[model samples]
Target chain A: MRKFLGLVGAVALLAACETAPTDGANANASGDAAAQKLGPAAGSAQDFVVNVGDRVFFGFDQYNISADARSTLEKQAMWLKKFPGVTIVLEGHADERGTREYNLALGERRANAAKEYLVSLGVDAMRIKTISYGKERPVALGHNEAAWTQNRRAVTVVTVGAGS
Target chain B: MKFCVRFLTLAVLLFSSQAWAELRVDITQGRVEPMPLAVVEFTGDNSDAAQIGAQIAQVVSADLERSGLFRPIDPKAFIQKELSMTTLPRFGDWRILNAQALVQGHAVPQANGELAIQFRLWDVNAETQMVGLAYNTVADNWRRVAHIIADTIYQRITGESGYFDTRIVYVAESGPANKRVKRLAIMDQDGAKHRFLTDGLDLVLTPRFSPTLQEITYLSYYKNTPRVYLFNIDSGRQSILGDFPGMTFAPRFSFDGTKVVMSMARDGNSDIYTMDLATRQTRRVTRHSSIDTSPSYSPDGKSIAFNSDRGGSQQIYVMDSTGKNVRRISFGKGRYATPVWSPRGDLIAFTKMTGGKFYIGVMRTDGSGERLLADGYLVESPTWAPNGRVLMFYRETLRGEKKTTKLYSVDLTGYNEREVITPLEGSDPAWSPLIP
Candidate 1:
């Protein structure tokens, strides 16, 4: 196990030097923006999904919310509380490590975990819609852990309200 | 054996012929060395018969070759040319070429504008004929005739049913990695007679054919909502299995072709369900907080094998048809998923992931005797052949920023792994039963 981890670390170091810096910059910017936008009024649900960070990561084969995921969901709940008219869709996803059917169900569990947490923070339950994409739609294309960690996540997507 | 006696009587009364009975190949166990068989080109009674005869012989020989149990010797190595199906071949000549068995055939034009195909299997060393059969079919149905003939030869040699006449349904994928366009595709088991059942307009996955071979059940993203759909391949008609409140996927028909079992996700939880195709009535088979998907019915329709994470990680479990007395069957070091019950009702094939590698393996229904047949960076979704002697799955290989997925087949013995050629990338292949 240690050897496999070391191999992954070595590959990460080699890949770090070869790939473009754009991805790192984008990821860092998103984390920074979410931290900055946690408390203030986000103006719209779309802004909440983007600036306050719409997605939260999970551990391997786990649907339980991690501490880091909890912090991100707190910010999302605050953003949701500010926009009364805004409704959101929680899109669940998983890494490609699991089977398609199981991943779909796991994605659902992850999305609902986030949704339940937001509801506990006073967000309306009916305003949130959930869908599990399983491992089909992935933001990262690589096969390494760096890509898998990003893939196993649930993103809060803002949907247009019927009245709006 | 009957044909041999009949032939001997005729030879004694009408013509002078010599015959011998010998056991050429001892197939008590799996073939460690493929039996060498010489498939002589079938002679044509007429010019029209001759053209079709050659084509039939080519198909039959190709079928035997792909089986990996019989090696069809090259015709150029034959010491004798122009074999007549009525007369026995020279055993000394075949033995010199190291052929254990010989196949001789003839095609003749029949009455009513039909073609009659006759073939005889010879045991070279024993100098005795093993099988003699004749079939009359329309000229256009020559390919099927050839397949039937191959099936007979394979059964007589190996004492196992043949899967050569079967077909496979799969998801044909193309385009860039980010945006793959997938359609449901079908082809002969030999990768011939390829056809697309659906356009690339909507994504389709995990197609399974019914026992009748006329209908297919699969998951399609119709109207952007993934749901189970039944499609009639012959009529080009389709119908939704049911109006589920949420998504339904991973559909497979029961062995009896009466029920369609699938996974339906609702309220962030997925469970196994079955819908009777005849009445459209649905029943939930598994009720659990964790995800339980990929339900496959045992051949006897008495139990179902599926994968669940209820025990905190993905593992295979088997439950009765009523969803009672559920028992965990997989206790491996890593996770197991997609537990497909073998048609023979003895083993289950699954995808195992451990140490950052994916493997296709089979285990006894009780979760013992696990054997990893194939492994790669990303390999899953194994479908068994009609005869349950082989398995087909797709493998994905990473090539820098992109990956390529292709279909591959391996024997149950974990040997003879070969690619199932496709024009485009493929995944989620489902093998159909032998064509009736």
Candidate 2:
């Protein structure tokens, strides 16, 4: 009789362990799904946030496509493909070293350069729109080279749309 | 003994030569304070006529004083008893009253049923007649005669063109912040005779008059899209400059008023483009990865001064008309924007932001000698008066629970700061040429 009680106790313990193990695995999977939803993943990629501290440089007031800018756009394009439904607005900015009107024009060219590269990588051109704030808005207000590099950037802002 | 004699002779020769030459009193360091003069009642043929003459003289006095460069003295303090322009005044009387200059004038009715106005400016210290001018106009144009007389005297004393007979074209605002309405308004420099060119059907910003004072080009948001529109001052007709598929803002007429320079945005980028008003041909001046706007032409129309962020932050830059040979001019401690070339071509005025504060400043074209003239919560859009002696800009104040913006003017010397009176909140002031 004691031997029989031991077997029943072992069965009850195994049943409780099985329930707890399945619950933990479910929690882990959901956390990963949330992360994948927030960030770029495989299969669907187009709109990706540039990591903090990364920079996109221009060639002396020229906003034409450059090799380095292409490499950066390549990475962004991969992430954008992972999230196919995302639409983006490319914001072009200029540093505080030129006239207001010319800076505005330069900013437009910069944003367009990024947009063209993305479209070449199979991102829909219709998914992107550009806006030049001229010198009206500045992310870094310092009067130094470091601040200017940050201010002169083309940012891809993601939004939810019907593409996916 | 022989050397000493030669030295003494040379010294005497030098002193006499300096004295015989024009005694130029390097007047650069004078008190920029306005000169004080007295305009008394003109003693005429009849008492009733004298009252009318006095009224005309008073108007002239007010015109000069309001310029912020002159101070009209009280007639009651006049030391001279003779107020007639035909008679020679007692110059010693004006000197005793601390008047550096005195104006005496008389008005008489002519046989042709017109008014003949005669005026004279007297130098109190030199005890001599400085200038005398005469004008014949109908009785209703007495105010204009006063202005002309003021201009003549102002030119003689200050040795500069007078700005009393000028006007200003500015954007007038009404209603609340989100759904505000703006109209292009023109008024005398003293803020009189305010007239609205547009019936508030659309929004307007930055209205600048042509060099001929006959046309204006400004940015308007008429069809839910912002574009530069040109309007004839006399005909009251309007037209758009180009059919850009995107936004266009910050428009200015070229120095010759033949071309319009503005910023056009397409595909999420804005670039500086110019269009010939007569030909309607468009050309892209800048192709850059940065935002460039607020372009101004040099007085000679050879170069343009604009604001950009290509260097990572906003700064002032100058370039040739074809967008070549570009050079950055501003290297100050703050972010500089809205660079405007002075009409005199000596300085460029701009708005600077630093340390959470904004300042109106002027710098030489080469980006040297940056001087901040004024500070406020927010200051932008520095426009030069036609003479380049004064700047008119707008300032915003951050106080209480609401924000307020108003127009203000300051001389290039950083003195004579005064608030430009407007009926409502206003910004983006552009001074116009003197009316012909």
Candidate 3:
């Protein structure tokens, strides 16, 4: 029973670390106060995504939705249900590992995978648009796996909603 | 036009009579040591023509030297001075200076304000003239005249087509890596007369010269949407290509210049498509769900080579012009992309990524005899010179916290790899055909 408890605690810690920023730097270094002003508001598109996470990452050269990605989309679906008039744009990206054109296509596949998952969870297919930036726009500048994992992500940007 | 006719006549006569000892250069051995040659100062009739004569000789010397095939000896080493075009050169004198070949020329101003340039190539060992030719062109075209002269000499010795009279179109990048401003730039093959065609307000990539060498096709981020665009370099006019339902990029002109083959993304699938520039008819080339892009038409215009992920990883594949008989051509260990068919129709240049390194390589059309020419942290987009003997690509290096990109070229023998000087960070170079 003690070993079982320790195992559960380790699993819980791993889960928490997965939710943290992949890069060592804090994405929100200003803390909750500045985040509140610039952050999403309640009953808003920004609020729905930010409060429930707006993006999901993939392994190198892999685009299939992982278990963590599914959970993030589940929260996104629940939040999306709160705002019916909101239209979202799924912007897919890739790490700088492949050619430009191939990466662009890979990004598109990732974005569509997320869009299909959202549609499966009762979101309107017409409300989501997909765009792939390929390896062009990388948020993480490092050339290692840590930065790559963060760069290979599909971001759910609320294009038309309360914030707009 | 008369000048052109006269030039052709002189070339024909000179080539037909060349049975003398030939100065053959074995390029397959690579640039272990450049062949040494001597170019005497060309004489001119007037002070103005004299200045042009000196400049022409200088340009010719630079062209041959840059090829890594010929090394022009210093004029200070010449024992013979100002040999007349009609007289034979003192071959023993040139041989004494360790020059295997000698070039003598003279420029004369014509009555119509055009310039007449005459030159002869001599084999120092055999003490005989290998070939002789003359050119008549407008005074303003002295540079091109020099290039043509250099081409003739290059062909006579190397027995390969020359790329001296060519141009290159590339992307000029500036600013920081986070916010790079790119412009479409063009210049002579020797990096002369460099100029930007675009305002840098829109991001441009992959500028390829059309078959006619009068226009260029490239991708642009216009209005925040990536799309293919065509620019009339001669007229300085730019226009967006045909509209599609979604984003379109990676455009290349057909070998015949009648159509453009590119990639279009729709419904989460990116596929290859070609449009007839004459009729404005769009046709789907590949219907596979895989990402098919970077299509390059073969030199014969009968087949197309492109990069696709349908094989589970990015590799090169070839198909007929109508998208039939598709077959995978790259079976190497790493991923291959940007398979550009060489102008010689003998090899395909591509970018390969493996073992965390990027390589610029070439392989036979059937995917055999793969040879890598350059490797770097990030190198891609291989473009071929008109002669198909040299390749130009960009290399990106990561330094601590900064990344710097520059243009580089390498010959087929994997030697003579050198950086091509650009005013700013350069990428995606397209070599133009030999200018008429």
Candidate 4:
């Protein structure tokens, strides 16, 4: 009975480890307050994510800003205005469906699409930087379209603000 | 390509071997039956030498068998047990076993600590020596000698250069799907003598070997900045290839090894560029808004083949080395990426996606003679062996919730697909030119 329980515990631990976006040290340290399940502090990185949503999705092979993404960018633009001293980095990612080199270019286009939208919405372009992870870093773990739709997104990471 | 010219040369032995003028093997086209040949264990003077000789024969047999052109006959069927190396084999014995050819050799220990090895290839039915040679090497490097002998046999039979004596550089991957740790790794073409070229602190991908030097050009994400870097295998030194304002990736060497062509993405756009290694001067190859990457130079260095989406879909395009004479070469129903020109300049291997299936295929220079060599759920990055007879690529499949990525190789005939065994998951394999 003890051996059976131990095996079950080990499998559960493996499942938990495989499903999350465990991008090494920084990722583990980023979500302490959220893990505690408390209401996020105002203007915190968690607050920005919980209130205004930091990610915007793109269509397959299309880098043009969509109407839905524009809505999210509008909210992000207002948040940036509230925290004028905040600096953000736009991280572009692609689905694993494409080649490595092409996905990198497409990812850059996705991030720049969000960056250009933020610039047009009255945020300072200098305060925002863009980097493309291609398909190397994904937030999701599946190989289906559900995961791909989430993978093909540009995430706004708060570089300097409440987290610091 | 010059240092080992003497020991490497297989003395053709023209006048004595070619008494019969009939062609034995033709692997250029069509389906080929693996020529049945008897590869006997080499005889040696001492026990240590005998063990080494048997190991050499095993390697030689495995190398020839892996090529899919020759079938090493099972040694258990040998009718005659003991035989002297100098005396020719009884032709009737080999003929009884239906072996078209016979191979025998002897290993002797030299006084100065080198090993002297002599091998002969006999056309059993022709009743004559097809080819024979003796070479010397340090005892530890007997595996290399075996590979060289395999190449000699392959060339003598098939009339094409063998890819046995080569190395492959690839990306070694671990961790999980979201945050993978990738390091640069290299090994023998048959997956022996493996070594890691970089620590896994940073991400690296797509390493390519220089055509004429022991250097590698690849993409590295050092200090969290993704760019192309060159590494010298002998010195263990690495440096960024060029100073570009934007992100640089997808680097490959020109045929002459004088220039490196790569893609630089700036402000949401990527284009092809070439940089001279000696002068550090840069030349832009493509000035387009669309993504143009994965640039490969032709063997003659007159043309450049690259992947671009300029025609509204991902396709392969060829232009003059100066970026003129633009032409689309893929008119098929799928999108193509990573167009690598064969070292022989006859075909271009590429990754194609259609109907949600990824295929590694090869096409003629003009985009005709399209042949899909291998297909899977997701396959990308097709690189050719130095001889241009086989291709190595990575294949990924989803098993339950886990993703399995592995390296695979297949010859041009669409048969003989093999999984190249590596310690860890490997991708983006680049086959080096034959080590001289």
Candidate 5:
């Protein structure tokens, strides 16, 4: 009878531990889950989705892929390989400090750089189309360093077949 | 004798009343809207004459309406008694339709088989002959006659020269990013008759016309080296203006077409420099560490207005042709660039940036009465039409993920904003003087 009572007490202790009153920890876990939901799907087999804040730095006015950009692109390529049906549009952008025509050319180079990197990583070149918005479209409207960093980027937007 | 005296007294009283009692309405502002005008079909002596007359009239109507300052009212709405241009206009009929102005013309095939078009403008409110113009051109030159008629009407009403006979030279862009193909493009001011001057082998920008309207000077990135080049518009022949080693940009011809002023960069700094076209001699106009570009000569060619960042930020400055008497002109609450001195020499126009907003503004030479004429997400490169009464600039609008840039123009009065139609995206418009 004492052993049976001790077993019941042990089970009760396990239940207490499982449903402990760690409210802050539970809230944090839920918050992380929400963020995961909001973020682009990872480990997808189809196409890779680049978030807006993802940085794609360039060497001056160049659009050539740097080593740092390659690693990020490799991760993107892995996701794209998983999703065979997904397609992406690589959008190139430029900072506001240059002439309009030159910046347009620079933006195109940046987008093409990202696209070429993705292709080199085994993603289908045909799956990626590139366009340059030049300095006309700025993600950040400020004229400071933060805005320039944001503006000088290329975003990979994922799309399904025939639709967005 | 007593009856005559009484009649004279009455006539004197009537004349006095008419002189003093004329309706004095102060037109401080008219509808910034285009003046609605009616152009009836021109009557001709023969069927072919009538056809040519109608074509000329249509051209005139199109020219006026395209200017954005005049809205050629639809002739379909006309209740005029006669559609034929040969008939005298019934003033009462035009007045009933509320047309502020009426244009009527006649085309006749001369004995030499050429066309002679005569037109007249009637101020409906004034009920008098505003002006009469005549044009003689070959059968193929009917369009020219039409344009001339439009110019007459425009000049009579606006008290300014018409830009109908002008052309714009701009850089045409195509191809994907990184490998852009640029060509020199010229088109009518209304954005028609587009022709690419270059074969897209080099990159070109900031094309300007000489006062004679025959020569163009612009910067070309040929063989990866940027230099100023001059091209004869009529012959399509081009040559490098000066043998400069570094980058040369923002080029403009002098008023007499005898010199070229541009910004040349060596090392990392840029300064304004001028080259005598005949002698190929170069002279530095400004010796500053800051960026000094977009140099424009005054109408008299004695002074220049340009933008420089020597004052910690970009502002406009004026200096003599010899690079003396340098003074700051713009003191507004913004960074100003691209200062273009008007052909009229009354005001200096510029592109201003403040609080992340771009503006096209104009100020007197003394930098007073500064007025922000237009605001946009991005508006740059303000070029004056030949008349100095209108300004053409480019605007860009941002969509969700796409951005589009187009050309637009506005009158100096802060009225008449209109889009110039182009087949592709266009910017950096430079208006040429009227072709002599």
Candidate 6:
């Protein structure tokens, strides 16, 4: 449980050098324009979705977190730790390939896996809630593997409101 | 879903096959040549009756044609076009076109606003009246009358009960793959009387029918919290079925419609549970850390077949009613889900995913004699017709196009596959037993 706590403490020390698909700089840039209209206030839901990396992807039909997801989760934990009063809801989703009911259960497994990681990172378990949408709500629209890779994910939604 | 046969059993096999050639449709064997049948336009005593009569005959013909056991000969092939209620059908004319059977009927509109339909099935090869029956229903229920008539003819010739006069409750999907709007929809076996049960405000899935009533148990994303719900189709009323502390889903009615068996996820792990309808009491049926879901009851309500990943990958497992004697039933290469017990109590239908492909398959109760019926890009949720001879599931296209889901049914032989027409894209179809 103590393995990931304070492991990636220096976000600025890494200097945003890597350029993975989930790189924070790239996502922040996309959310920047919308941030102006949507108001990505510090510790706001918009800020979490745009800057703190509120979502992470999984492999096909696999709920185990990937190495890429670790950096995102680390950022999410840092944001949650900074906002002591802000509670969050984690939503797990699946690709469209699996059966309906099993996918529902699988999505729950993914969300709980993320919750467990957050708890391991020192986030309060009582402050976090989880839900599974299965394949009902998808972020990607295509029928191919590329879209599915994006759809199989867990999203962290800040429930503490933007004004906070 | 219990069918109410209102008509008296007016049908009787009057003649033995020894006196004439047997005009039976052999349904047990696979790859059978459809028996040629001629369904005439049912006559009427009045103009209104004539129009309704024609519609009824068309519905009956469509039902028979879709079964794959009967090929309705075109009306143009009929030598005697004018079929009357009292007069016998010209068996010689049907024999000329090689039609083994001929059907003639008449519709009469009663003064009490009721419609009565009388029909006769003649074995053309035998030149004898194989069966005859009459049905009286409200004028608005003429469609159901047609279905009942079709069932009668099918049973008389096939020597097995019919699957017509049934209904299907499914999630009707619209919009794009990412923003699909799913609503509860119901229709007859032939896709008639289509109507939406839900307004699509909340996401819904996997609507299943009670074997004994006009009730459906399903999973609904109401108030953004997923749970099992029960819907009374007759009253347009809905209620949450399980008031558990955790998420409840994948619900199915017990054979007697007295309880709902489903999966509940608590602390991230899912396990099967059964809730009695009378007492609103729930009993945990499976205790495991891994996922245990998609519970279905055997016809006798003695055992249950469910999908579980306790063995590391999804597979079918069987356990007694008390959740004891747990045994894995599927030993296939791919992951299995949705193990639906057949009404006949001898087979279980399932969806198997292997080698990146999906299949709707069936196997014996013990999981032996596994046979794949249909395969495609995405196929799942296999439900049985009341007769247990046909299986219905939904399919999706996942390549070279925007993904789309639709309903389909395949018989046991696997040779007669047909798409069930719907108003929109459909998925997670649950077939009701024969409707009375």
Q: Which candidate number would show the highest DockQ if scored against the true structure?
A: 6
lDDT of 1 by residue, A62-139 (tens): 878877778778887887777677788888889877777788788888888888888988999999988887887876
**To one decimal, what is the Cα RMSD in angstroms of model 4 from the true structure?**
6.5
Q: Estimate each model's TM-score.
A: 0.87, 0.70, 0.88, 0.91, 0.70, 0.91
Instruction: Write model 3 residue lDDT over B59-105, tens digit each, in one string.
Output: 99988988888899999978887687666677778889999988877
Candidate 1 vs candidate 5, lDDT winner: 1
The fnat scores of all predictions, in order, read: 0.59, 0.43, 0.47, 0.78, 0.00, 0.82
Count clashing residue pairs in model 1: 1
- Model 6: residue B194 alpha-carbon error in angstroms: 0.4
- Cα displacement (angstroms), candidate 5, residue B54, comes to 2.5
- Show what share of the native A-B interface contacts model 6 retains: 0.82
The first chain of model 4 has a TM-score of 0.76
Candidate 3, residue B254: lDDT: 83
Chain A TM-score of model 1 versus the true structure? 0.71
Alpha-carbon local distance difference test for all models? 0.82, 0.70, 0.84, 0.87, 0.71, 0.85
Tens digit of lDDT per residue, candidate 1, span B305-417?
A: 99888997889999999999899999989999999999989899999999989999999999999999999888999999888888999998877867889999988778778
What lDDT tens digits, residue by residue, belong to model 5 across residues B323-374? 9999999998977878888988998888888887789989998889898888
TM-score of 3: 0.88
Badly placed stretches (over 4 Å) of model 6 are A1-39, A161-164, B1-5, B8-21
Candidate 4 lDDT, A95-152, residue by residue in tens? 9999999998899889988999999999999998888899999877888886787788
| Error of model 2, residue B168, in angstroms | 0.3
Which candidate achieves the best lDDT against the true structure? 4
Which residue pairs collide in model 5, if any?
A45-A82, A45-A83, A46-A82, A46-A83, A108-B177, B43-B85
DockQ by candidate, in order = 0.46, 0.18, 0.43, 0.63, 0.03, 0.66
Residue B285 of model 1 has an lDDT of 94
lDDT of 2 by residue, B1-436 (tens): 0001000111111111122122112213523677778776654455544566777787678767766677888877765667655456777787788887778767667687566666667676765666665666666666556666776676777666666666678878776543567788877676766788888878677788787777888877686455789888778899987888887888988877798888777665557899998899999999885777888889998899888788987788999988998999999887888888898888999988888688998999898988888888778778887777778998877665355778898877676678889887777788876555
TM-score of chain A of 2: 0.64
